[model samples]
Target: IADQDEHCKKFMEALIPEAFRKLQCSHPIDHWAGWL
Candidate 1:
């Protein structure tokens, strides 16, 4: 978002974070005892 492209920022902001969230959410490491 620090770049000069407003359109790119908005498009990437919506798309990139969603991809990472799904990737992180699907990871099975959350089930571990020290996961806290």
Candidate 2:
């Protein structure tokens, strides 16, 4: 279970940046940065 959790964490870390990059392309970074 711990190994699965670690794998998920690593996957999310990789995925999140790509997701953010897509979002930035569709919207303005400043808009989302304010929310963050």
What is the overall TM-score of model 1 with all chains considered together? 0.48
Q: Tell me the tens digit of each residue's lDDT in model 2 across 1-36.
A: 999999999999999999999987878766778899
On the 0 to 100 scale, the lDDT of residue 4 in model 2 is 100
Backbone clashes counted, model 2? 0
The global Cα lDDT (0 to 1) of model 2 is 0.91
lDDT of candidates 1 onward, in order = 0.81, 0.91
Off by over 4 Å in 1: 1-4, 29-36
Cα TM-score per model: 0.48, 0.68
Candidate 1, residue 16: Cα displacement in angstroms equals 1.6
